[model samples]
Target: MTEQNVDLGKNPRANRIPWPPLLLIASIAAGALATWVWPLPWPGINDGPAHGVGLGFGVAGIALIVWAIITLRKRGTTFLPDGTATSLVTSGPFARFRNPIYLGDALIVLSIAEITHSIWFVAAALLFGILVTALQIVPEERHLESQFGDAYLDYKSRTRRWI
Candidate 1:
């Protein structure tokens, strides 16, 4: 709304809302909560191939999350987007996409929809994606830009935000 309400700090979560946990909550709410709150007319997929594909996506999403966390550990930086940054991470899954963990979350949410065959879950997942991108990722990116300056700009120029 007003410039006074805006925060352009390198660590923008000064308001105390952590990004990673918020994203985790969003994904869970999107998938799990929606699954229960709005049960599908036809729950569960019977086809073997479809189940395999859904399982594969879910597993891949988990793998990406694991890899991203490992990379963050290797970089000596916390995974929380709003946390203090020890280093500019640009390796492993990060080389491919800036927000691998968030991408993983999206995949997980999507996988839930696929596995459950729930259009409502899909809607929730989509809402999760949109909300995270707007409320979290944008601010985190601004924080990074403030923190890392040209280096972050260069990386932003090079890497896709999501892949």
Candidate 2:
């Protein structure tokens, strides 16, 4: 993709701050607050099956995140969204998904929702996904497309954004 092809100027807020972790934290806090103030009855949240599902998802999410981080580090690329990526990494978890870390984050949010028995966390997860897409993923994609050009585009085409 050409520089002109990617509209980096569409969201000014995206480039200003490190939003991913902050957004995740904010979502969790909001969910927790909501749960405290107005706890909704989630029927199966306390069940053994629900806890098992949450545990499984949490493990998978953490594993995916760690794998992605290791892959980026091994390739000498910056995993931080705001940092300049030294290399276009397309191995390990990256081979399967362009945004494995973000996917992991999303999974962790779901895990939290299940573990905490909070319907509000499910809402938070949805909100977090939407906000991160607009504020982090879109900008990051534009930057990558601009920085890596056709190679990034090709990788993007072959690999799903989230799996």
Candidate 3:
């Protein structure tokens, strides 16, 4: 039997942000701000119908987070800012989208905004996600391409960046 090995170079820009730690901090900050500044309205204090809509958004956001986590775990992947992969995963949720984590994060943010009925926050989150993806995600893709080459390229071609 013969084994073929492929070399994927080390990513120069990997682990840029210490993402897990940063994510924790950001989550705390966001939660604090939301609590201090724009706390959820007390039930019966606002329009009844709109409450249902808001709750739906909140639920959707939670659902997306759960789905994203499951996908990552099943694929043996992480959402770290750095683009490092133990293996090329082209199955499960990844088969449908190139960046399920990003999509899920965006959905959660948008859902929170909608739930809060904060147009300003919704727009801000959308812009933030776009910028983060551009600055962080795109470069990571470049690194993946450098490493995985044609396989990554084929995956890129087949999967949508955000869907």
* Candidate whose lDDT is highest: 2
Query: What is the lDDT of every predicted structure here?
Result: 0.73, 0.81, 0.59
Superposed by TM-score, candidate 2 places the C-alpha of residue 34 at a distance from the truth, in angstroms, of 0.7
Clashing pairs in 2: none
- Residue lDDT tens for model 1, 1-163: 0011123344644224665567667666666766677676745567989878878878988999999999888877778765655567888998999889888887877777777787666676677778778877888777777667777788889999888
User: Number of clashing pairs, model 3?
Assistant: 0
TM, every model: 0.81, 0.87, 0.68
User: For candidate 3, lDDT tens digit of each residue in 1-163?
Assistant: 1111156455544447654334433543564476567665433325767667666655765665567566566666554666465455666556777666655555566555555555544544566566666666688678777666777788889888767
* Runs in model 3 lying further than 4 Å from the true structure: 1-5, 12-15, 18-53
Model 2 whole-model lDDT (C-alpha atoms): 0.81
lDDT of 3: 0.59
TM-score computed on alpha carbons, candidate 3: 0.68
Q: Give candidate 2's error at residue 161 in angstroms.
A: 1.3
Clashing residue pairs for model 3: none
User: Could you tell me the lDDT of residue 130 within candidate 1?
Assistant: 80
- Arrange candidates by TM-score, descending: 2, 1, 3
